[model samples]
Target: MPSVNRLLHPSEAAKRLGVSAKALRLYEQRGLVEPGRTEAGWRAYGQEEMDRAAEIVALRALGLSLAQVKRVLEGDSQGLEPTLAAHQAALEAQLRQLARTVEKVRGLRSDLMQGRAPTVDELMNLQAPLREVRVAFELPWPWGGELFELRDIRSLNYIIGPLGSGKTRLAHSLAEALPNAAMLALERLEDDGVTAAKSRMDSDPILKSRVDEAISWLVEDGANSSDALVVLLAGLEADGPDALVVDMIEQGLDHATQEALIAWLRRRGANARPLFMLTRSCAILDLSAVGPDETIILCPANHSPPMQVAPYPGAPGYEAVATCLASPEVRARTAGVVAWRPSSGRLQSLTP
Candidate 1:
């Protein structure tokens, strides 16, 4: 039996809690949990700290923000009700899916007992939810018309390349090729765009609420609200499109805003709508944060066909993707430097 007052090291405590040591460190940083320090300065989690940490983890798993968790931990129950209701609804949805799976299995078993054999395809269709959505289309201009096949389109897909790499054209082509997809162009930041975005948000109360919640969460994560961001996010959170392709998703945002925005998007989970974001900011395209439900598409500088890059250090195109991305500060510094493509006879900058 474990000692009631025994203290465990950070790694041991994290293992016991089914979380990572980094998560515990985050909890500590947020003042959500306070662990003791050993004589050698190593962190130690006692029973009290472990209980508190577990509560924080549970609250986070229920979709509550760190700020919301803090408020609930402070004995304020107002925010808890809505979060609990959301969690309950999610669980209910999962239960319904599970029920359908059980029924399918029972039916299959009954048929087997009756000497009726099911086909392999029928058995495979039972796990339809786990299947990936694949898309194939012909590549657009700047490259010879080549076939582009994208398999297992994930929740978050990043399209990245240097200027003049035809990334924008690729994004547009994807939006055109994919079913129920639309591209949110940079013109959305033009004059009167915010008004149009506001109108759309006003037309859909649920979408507006979701956007508001996301904005609040981003704000808590150190993001500053802007008309540009609001316009972009309204489209992203809107319900009509099955997928969205965004050009320069980190445009007009500072480093903190970019980081917070990406973090917020990542937290939306694997079931969220597929999003194709064109970004060159390291903050927006953090390779380390790429999950199984996220994919990176890199358009090589040499005009080779765009290929999906695995989120590992040594993967082909992985280094290219990393090279294309810059720290938000670096991106800001070089934002005005345009690539010069000289026309025939005389050196002239290419214009849209």
Candidate 2:
């Protein structure tokens, strides 16, 4: 009897799994497997890998991509199960609709064969009701090659900038741009404004209570419509989970606060419609200054001048700004001004 000691090459494993070796290579490219290697640097696979290969084929039969199958096998099943289930449900729904459509077509064929006078409504109304399927397309913003499209907006986003550098202006602009956005003015959050709101947002009970309060306000004000966009604005940063607060921190947000906010955003940012816009002020506003996980910086036309801009919830709405700012001509005009460093402050464009 052959024992499990036989190490299989990728080709052998593919043959055993009843799939082509090309399929296994494709899976590997997608981080599905970390194959071992022989002394000659040839790829080798173990029994575990082979088993996973079989599972991959099975999942593909169910219409899963290699990336999706790898996600399933990796045990990070948080969102995959629902997604797969949704796909199955959609397929079932489509099959039913197709069956009805086929039956209608057969009936129409019979009517035509009988030489009956076909009414316009009779032929047109035979089709099923057209359901509006929401599909999001990634549209590129003209400003600095930025891309903006519908996505799940998170409850927390870090907007880093220096103090009084038009942070609030941008934030307010975004608030106005976002339709029905729920604005939470962290009145009690700032040291000078509200010390307690900062502490309140840092805790789960207080945070939940405050969020609920904001929601209640929106509902009562008739602003909580289905298409309402919620903008959670917190002033004066505190280190805590689920708080979408931004402050001017030149070195980036405090470690604890940054981690908490990132985790919070990841969870709430999973929405499909992106109904929320998180606005806050960060001290460290340079996108290239810190690590990618730390900040999503919005750079100016030129990558220089290192001035930080607070991320307004929806201010500088990329789409609208792109329509106005979209031009290679603008960048070319501004190119000369980059080298002209001011001795005092931000430069004002003299160009008309």
Candidate 3:
């Protein structure tokens, strides 16, 4: 008898589900969904498995924890109340914003009827709220003063380059140029500094609550708890600064942690503020998993001006960007390894 076939592979399932293959692995780890093993021992998602995974993904979209999702799946409705309330509040806020936008549109139409035309900027802003948000500056030290201007910045952006490529300077320049933006570098390593940071969190219940929730989610998603994770989450959950530029986002994270962290960062909702993260870890900057709302900026090794790199192959700077990325395991192996910088400020080192 012929065997019945036609189950999707993890990558195909992930593509259809609008999530990363890593996410499906995490879901399986959390006992959320189980895919079938093929005759060759490969995981295959049949219809039943896909349906279950889809339910878990939907619950996650509603901001439900994996544990909470399991509870709901097991016929326990208790965890739904708070999540639904928060979802309702977010929807209501969006409704209010839409009402204001409608009022603006009506006024614009009235002006048109009265023979008054709206400016291009006004029309663009009306059509796309974020269109007016722009970043413009000159390329910094490593390159000559080349003008750079970016409009409609996405929520998650990556700045990647080889060592001594001056990605750090570019990140700092971005933070300085963006209005109401802040930079969180990897400089808080001293014992005293860690203690002080924890003390601040312990003192502020509200801040502590936000940080704790973020930590719990990351931990549940297979990330290891560490001082580095805590510091990053504190900045991410803090209630100030419209945008953030993070230096070396995967600095102290392990392989699993880096995978989980990037997955979590990608799940930030549509209204999430812009984030410009500098990273070379392949896990953190997985070209395959990049979505429409993410952008990649590559700093060339030849000290040329930084330019945006498309996720696809053959695009300008795509190979350079790809060559710069290393798996988290490889990166960890090379941790604390540095190349000597020469008089020209260019360091000689192969990609990690």
The prediction achieving the highest TM-score against the true structure is 3
The lDDT, on a scale of 0 to 1, for candidate 3 is 0.83
- Model 2 TM-score on a 0 to 1 scale: 0.29
Output the worst ten-in-a-row residue range by lDDT, candidate 3. 343-352
Q: Report the C-alpha lDDT of model 1 over 1-352, residue by residue, as the tens digit.
A: 2333788999888877766675677678778899999999989988888888889878777777777888889988775777688778767777787898899999999999999999998798787663256788889878899999986788999999988899999999999988889899988988787899999889889989988988888887668999978998898988788899999999889987887787678666676789999999988887765767899999999889999999878999989998898988888788879878566645433332
What's each prediction's clash count? 0, 17, 0
On the 0 to 100 scale, the lDDT of residue 272 in model 2 is 17
lDDT of 2 by residue, 32-82 (tens): 776788899999988777666677777665544344566668775654564
Better of 2 and 3 by lDDT: 3
Error of 3 at 7 (Å): 2.4
